[model samples]
Target: MQKELNLCWNFGCFYSWSKTLGCNLTMQVQRLESGDFDLRNRQLQFSTFQIINVVRRESIEIGYWTAKQGIFRNLNQDVSAHTYLHPMPDLNPVVWPGQTHIVPKGWQIPTNGKKLQVGVRTSGYPEFMKVERDPVTNAITATGYALDVFEEAIKKLPYAVPYEYVSFDTLGVNYGSYNDFVYQVPLGVYDAAIGDITIRHNRTSYADFTLPYTESGIAMIVPVKDNTNKNTWIFLKPLTGDLWFASIAFLIYTGIVIWLLERRIRNAELTGSFFHQLGTAISFSFFADRERVDGILARLVVAVWVFVLLIITSSYTANLSSMLTVQKLQPTETDVHELLKRGEHVGNGGSSSYVRELLEQLGFERSKIRAYTNPDDFADALDKGSKNGGIAAAIHEVPYIKLFLAKHCKGYTMVGPIYKSEGFGFAFPKRSPLVDDFSRAILKITEADAIIQIEKKWIGDEHACKNDETIISPSSLNFKSFSGLFLVTGVASTSALLITLVMFLYKNKHKMGINIGHDHVQRGHGTELETERIQESTADSNILHRMIQMTTPASKR
Candidate 1:
């Protein structure tokens, strides 16, 4: 025995111990086949001792000694005081001083001993967990996203953890909810619940949840419209109704204003019925042939009005062409709030704890929501919409909804931004030591792309959903986008109109005999010239009289 022990310690050979007279000591090593120069190799261990006394415990005699540590300093020390004792100090090097994670002294967990109990869902959710019956034992075999992630996280742990997945069932009935599945951990029915268990506030009050490894949120899935322009009226789409009305009103207004300024002039082109004048003004916008405007004021109005018409017509042509060539499929409801206001039926995954409460909190009544169990329900909800007794949309966590879309990739799609959630996490009993360990390991697993690998393995083929019918939504021109440019044009036109008005009044002032009188008429101009001047003055005065008559009421006149 001594010879084998010497060889084992020196050359890492097999060794055995046999009973010998007065030789009861046994040695242990820190590691097997350690390098000769390894500092940890300086270890020789003896089984520890614990002396318990049933009666007269204080009178017990105990001697603690080690070649490296030394004997107990106070042999006369009360033995009863050593109820909770530690091994004698040794010369072996202390590892990771102060950084040692003290196992929470409650439960003694064998690092690689007992098989860990993992609870899983048995309803066969593919993205989170899916269980199958083994052909031989008929035992449920678990697999999928959550199972993969759990396995990956365990592998990333510093030590191997033996585990067996047991599906949650009662009397051979499958689990009713993920919440109940999570409760199994706190109930001691499971060491951990491994599935897509959402990290909810209420659940976290009692259960420990690891940091989410998947993105968190609820989103809406709806059927994509097959025809983009099914409900649209094509002709009226070029300009909004409000803009169309305003354009027509301005066209007539330009005609009236121009007639008032030019009607008194001898060479005026406004000598026509009011309808004719309006038609002419409106036609200028369409680039129709027309006579030249007679006066500066008339020309100024025409030029500015024509420029405005050019812009309006150009915008109309471009929009008309787009609406005709492309298609516009606007979403019926873009947000949860909009759906709530419309009282549209909305579907939810069968057993999510937050879906109903979240909708209720957002002000939707409970009856407005429909709960769906599988793909058929989802398809019915979309195929028949709310008015036909089906839901307008189905809302579920993004992961589940993504799986659903991938399978039924033909006409369905997930829409709407996600509402915030904490996501799916591993659940353990509150304050379990594994929580931090699992969370840290999760970071590493995700960083090393193992999570991505697992997800791709399960869902890589699910991306076959492609749709050529995606709506090409044409951006409607809002008034604000063009308001600044229109404002500049408007201001320029008004300034020109005002200048022309001032000049027209100033030039016609003397003809009206308002700025000058007959007493100031030149005497050198004789009878014939005086006659012509009086006749011209009378004619000009008559025009002023007609203008006043047209503007005033009979009582004021």
Candidate 2:
């Protein structure tokens, strides 16, 4: 460790005491007059003293090997302070004759300042960078994601840094004047340009950038799909063709099953001619009246069928309600590609170089594209449509598109896959000390979820626009949805009929003249009543014996 020697070198140099590592308490006091000092490869000059750590005390200029060269390479999944700047480990140390080389920071640092001139733009990008001026006060007010990020970063600094945001004439309220802010930073017109300045190759060549505060991407704002196409068969949407046919079949099958079982018993509800029996069967299933069903089999079948019908009807009603209430919105154009294919005019902020590149790639000619400055122009363009000098879709970044959506709730929406981007970052002169400091502060802010809070403050909540369904989707039912219901009714009706038939055949076997011989009956005059009673008693005994046999254990048998 080098200790600070209290030798006055210049009028700016002051007397200060500092200790070096690995020294006994050997007291030595020395004072000297002003002299020229050199730190060029002299190892033995300051061997006895330690230079005080000025990094924390002053706005030290930190020399940096440009991290942006391969900053994005081998990027870790984690978005944290430590991983924010991918240090160039392969960087060889550089030496300047008078400049003190800051090792470990991996670059040399010289003298710097505490004051900053922050360059600002007049883009008025709603939530990201809203630059406004008061009419009466004429005071310029700056607020947005960019401003919040800049302010939050400053708050995390160990030492206070005073900065004033100055609006640049270079970026004078143009629709897409992003390059203007970046160009001014390298010219010393501003210490840093702090707005939604994307870290691109051309900009970084002349300047340095902090870890991006916001995600960078290109997106678009398009008109919400028109839902005015009235569906004539909307009622039929609750159930598909297969389900409807299956439902009708089940109802008829249930009616027929009830009629078959009840008609044999001479039941008033079921014992009728073919047409009458059909009507009764249909009524019993639809109205599901169990009171008229005389036999246990008919009642049980009707009960299960009715339960199944209840479930089916309930589901249909609920689905139908959802289908009707939710507005199925389809976009006027799916994306820029779709627009290009159809040769439809797209609206965009003409000043954007990024957008121009993207539009040209999508095959949209400059003449086919319309430039819109404000909400009124965009609204008019969208209303007119592509056929009548109108725009099929609007193009902008996600942040700007989000602001537009918030302002116009139902009229417009964002669509298409977000193009890959580097995200938004603060711009600084090449190798400025603020880069590392800003990265650190940003990490702290992100870790604390301050970014989210700031975004909510400016953009409001996204849930406000979620009330309407913003897509085109037809609502329809499928047989799979009602499979369980059909299964229940089918099984119950079949089981009841089988059980009833078994009981009936068993009870009437003697009367039907089966499994009985005339030699087993004693012939007698005026014994018909007695014979009938005997037959019934025998039938009851047989039923009891069969039931007992069924319930008896196999082991015991």
Candidate 3:
């Protein structure tokens, strides 16, 4: 069969082939002889090459060789022998021809010397990670505690590994959340992600996380209410129940001692009805300078008791005054279980959807949960409260809540249970060796107190919650606080009673006859004379006589 040959025309060219194969043709074409070159009589020449049964398209090269050039001429020996190409037919149908993307293991420093593309969250959590863009130049600046830690960690590496931050918003119009941002690492969109991105179990399926650098837990924040107006028994709050009982008991004891001492001295004012005597005794204890004491022991007891009373009263007054004047800020709500049971609406901020899931897990109805994107939204929602179309409380991670409280520290406070979490961490592709390095670096920085300095730099000491709800509420005075005073008063009262008894017995020894085993004659006469003398003295003293007469009513007289 004479199949037509594929021919080409050239200004001056020729070819010679020694052998040819059918269907798959392999030919050796040689260059023209030296004498074949004619410059003046230039004419077009043509050459032919043929292959039978051309079933598939492929690349084949047809080139002329000269004696001066010595190089590999075998067609099958070199793949580059054929520069011009053809499409090869599919020989294996089982294999997929589409290319699958290869994710690089970013644990190693890139050999290409390109900066690692680190993705950062753009909105919310400004204390941990903030992304700012210049209005005119569109330049991005990533800062805050998270960024500071990340840069410091990079410096700890043995080899220099450069990185740049690319900002994205989880609450953007695209409705992306923090989980989506973390997935970017495995998708080869980012080499790493840093921010207040919490390390969670579900996210580990797509990416890996380094050890947590900050405190881990979700907390609730609510507006603080000034309870100074709401507390009705504020006066009673200054002293505990035990303290009150102890004080009253001491007051009564001191008064009884004073009245008994005055009665022993025949101070007729102490002589009255049972009820009248009780009233007289109480007045002597509390009402200062109400009555005068004659006995030295009574005076000493009263002086010590009075000192105790002065200290107790002063402390109570000072504490009560403080409670009444200072702003007693307290969280509007403190229990998460109560919030769940009441079905009160709660709000959450930032791009973390896990918070909603967590609320649901904690027995909160999904409909009762509201999501907020920014701090302002969170504040506004909390201020409105559940009854008024706002959330009753705002739930968020501790770091974010702290930042919020720092800014809104005046009327807001953190409360409720802190749900445990992994805290904030940097993310990378799965099994990234860089995870260990960064985790170790984090441990070092934390141990060295570098993280604290970084935290202070970004969050600042001034931004901390100054008016903590727990600290703002004044504690009541307990019995332990006044135990020393109670001891001193009790000792004085006991000693004065013993001394007074001793003095009375000594004064009456003459009437009783102190001689052992000897009975004195005229004991009755002696007692009678002593009694008469006492009556004569009582009647002679104008102060004693008037006191007795005034105490005695007209009907009694």
Cα lDDT tens digits, model 2, 1-557, are: 22233321111122221232111112122212135343767642321111122322332212121122212222232323333243344322222122334321211222232357787765545556767666797666787788988998887776456577777653454543678668788988888898877668788899998887765677767776657446898778789999999999988888888887887788776655798888887788767655777777888888888888888889899988777776677666665676688788887765456766778887889988777766567777887888887888888766666666667777776775457667678998898887998899987887787977887787767776652766557567789878988988999888877887888788898666743555446445338878889999999999999999999999997
Residue 79 of model 1 has an lDDT of 41
Q: Could you report the Cα RMSD, in angstroms, for every candidate shown?
A: 16.5, 19.1, 22.2
Cα displacement (Å) at residue 73, model 3:
46
TM-score of each: 0.63, 0.59, 0.63
Best by lDDT: 3
**In terms of TM-score, how similar is model 2 to the real structure?**
0.59
lDDT, candidates in the order shown: 0.64, 0.67, 0.71
Q: Report the alpha-carbon TM-score of model 3 versus the true structure.
A: 0.63
Tens-digit lDDT track of model 1 for 529-551:
98999999999999999998899
* Model 2 misplaced regions, further than 4 Å: 1-110, 114-119, 124-145, 159-192, 199-212, 215-219, 224-230, 240-246, 263-280, 288-292, 314-341, 363-365, 415-422, 428-437, 443-484, 498-557
Model 3 lDDT-worst window of ten: 91-100
> If both were scored by TM-score, which would come out higher, candidate 1 or candidate 2?
1
Determine which window of 10 residues in candidate 2 has minimal summed lDDT: 20-29
